[model samples]
Target: MKPPKGIRILLVDDEPHILQFLELGLSSEGFEIKTAPDGASAVEIAPLFKPHVIILDVMMPEMDGFEAIARLKENLSYGAGIIMLTAKDEVENRVRGLTLGADDYMIKPFSFDELLARIQARLRNQFPDLLGEVVHGPFRLDDRRKEITHQDKVLELSPTEYELLKFMVMNHGIVLSKTLILDRVWGYDFGGEENIVEVYVRSLRDKLGDKEHRLIRTLRGVGYRVDLP
Candidate 1:
């Protein structure tokens, strides 16, 4: 099969040399790369950048990576896996980054290949099934044909909505955590808000029309799942 495509990446840092190096390295791999010198610029351009992944540095001029991560995840389209890079190895910093919604963390002076590997790992986990047909009970999805239907009702789904439905159906019976759903359906790197999961689930429920034997079920504090009655 052809190589996976449609990867957009954003690099945010204050160092010109670091940005230049990462931009060049990742671009060589055929990923679209955008660079911002600081958190402010990253925020300003993020909507148009539409990056699936963002590599952010902890310290910057106007705003730190922590705030940037929170802001971007909240304001931008939910789900963009973010990787935090910093010189400090403090446990608090790592904890805080994750609390702020960073997907991964790396120390300063990291190898480009390692970073690329991390990005690819995130992508793989996010998009395990790029093509196929899956049928569970009355629900059916023909990915190759871009069609999904419940009892042949035919689901008209947005790209994101389709991805969410496909993932749930593929993992039928498993109560997937909102975090896992966000990373897989959205993008593993941009661990944005979890509310988007609820929103998408609601949309799917609306289209699927919950009735006697609902395919999607919530586990209260846990997450969600798709199953047959």
Candidate 2:
């Protein structure tokens, strides 16, 4: 097997020391690192940098992480894997990040190993030929393309929705708890606001039409499952 390709990473943080530390650590892990001290800089350099992933700090001057993300979303060429780092770990804040299109989130005072694991997990899922893509009945997913098709109808899913559905389908036939779904899909410790998952679930169901019932099964109080009819 070929060695994993180095993932280009862009680091956005107001803290100089933290940026430097991450630059050094990730670079040592065989990743190309780019540094942006503010959200504006992040926005400016993201397309040119063409990073495969981004480590964005939530709090920054001039343009906060949220605004920078919004700007990045406006440009498809710069839309890369987004992993938010922040001191705020509240359920509402975390949900907000996921809904706003982040691929994952990590709280402050984190371990470097954990961060690396999350990055690898996201990459593995997004490029599942690197891991292994999942298929069930009429559905097929190309994790790298972030594409899904059921009965040949292509799905246009938001980034977060894609992750949620992919996780569920990959673990089909098992009842997943809300906590597990939130942890795996959202990359946070679930804090009892699993309703956020439900909201996305509903959206997925609506898009899937009648096949929703055959594919996504709700367990009520537990979480969800996905399988073919």
Candidate 3:
């Protein structure tokens, strides 16, 4: 049987050549593809296209991947899976991206097979319902619909923000350290700079906007958690 519909994607990169390549590669697999050249444009098109996934480049002018991810989440315009594309394969970068809510991270010069596999993995994790939607407490995340609603109010979130929140909620009540989060979320172990995890947690809290008790909790010496009351 053909793959379910709404597996569409948006690919963001500064280079036209790379965007073209990704469009061609992903399209051949029967995925609908959209492209953007900068973070600003990406944020704009995310809600309009409402893709199921987004592949974002780390290095882009005007706004980097982290800032772009923040903007996306701020607008509540993305609920699709987000995979970060970076040039360097440093563990620190990987951890940082994941902490910011990216579902996966890949270094430059990667094979399309690996990219496709990552996409599949993220989809499976997010949409166990198979209809492309999942509910976590007060949040309703729709992967196929590319939407998120919190207690009736729609939340503006980047691909990364949504993924981060989803991961934390999925593993609620578990105390996850930065290393563990890095490995689980980014598919790597980044020993450098554990503070990046804190940064993302702060971002999540700020966007959540006065949530009581908060979904994310600080573990003192460890990392963080989304706990059940």
Candidate 4:
């Protein structure tokens, strides 16, 4: 599918060639693209650029992607997806990036096609339902506009929470493996026992309230199911 128009992307890399390559490719694919040489510069321009997705490099001279992840996570408008660019086969780096709030990561020496696919996944994952909305019991989610209402009140959900809720709601009444959920929602196979899914599920229950988890059924050895009340 063609990317939505005016969807801004920021490419941050210390290498001039790599930066230019991404800028050309992404811009050709109909995305509004910008490039920054380092993490600090990316942060400085992010507000004005208002990028919906940021492709961040891990090892910059001024500010590494880890520190930039913290600052960007703090300052960016909600739901800005971040993808880290790391060296080939860097498993620990990938984990660290995710822990630091990156939405996804890609290894160097990757195909432009692979990177494009990941980007598309991140953007489209939000509203795989319909453009209008998805409703179940007291909760109603506006997919196109990205809003959630429970018990007639709008809930302030983080980007992760929003995607998790949508995925579960879409698959209501079926048990979904944590691995499956991680792949579909996180846009990659995390391949670790990180408790990341559990962490997000806990936050979801907390926001939706204790009684709500019954709807999001938790099987002991299995995974989660959306049996909405």
Best by lDDT: 4
lDDT of 3 by residue, 98-197 (tens): 7887877778898776676567656657554564555656866676656677777777777767667766765565567877776665556455576666
Question: What lDDT tens digits, residue by residue, belong to model 4 across residues 32-141?
Answer: 99899999999999988988789999989979999999899889856688999999877898889988889778778878876876675566554243225546677777
What TM-score should be assigned to candidate 1?
Answer: 0.55
Top candidate (TM-score)? 4
Write the residue-wise lDDT of candidate 1 on 2-120 in tens digits: 12567788999999999999998888888888999999899988898788789999888889898899889987764777889988566688779988888777777887755765675
Q: Of models 2 and 3, which has the larger TM-score?
A: 2
Of the two candidates 1 and 2, the one with more favorable lDDT, higher being better, is: 1
Ranking by TM-score: 4, 2, 3, 1
Report the alpha-carbon TM-score of model 3 versus the true structure.
Answer: 0.56
Deviation (Å) of 219 in candidate 2:
18
Better of 2 and 4 by TM-score: 4
Off by over 4 Å in 1: 1-3, 127-229
Clashes of each: 5, 0, 10, 0
- lDDT comparing candidate 2 with the true structure: 0.77
TM-scores of all models? 0.55, 0.59, 0.56, 0.60
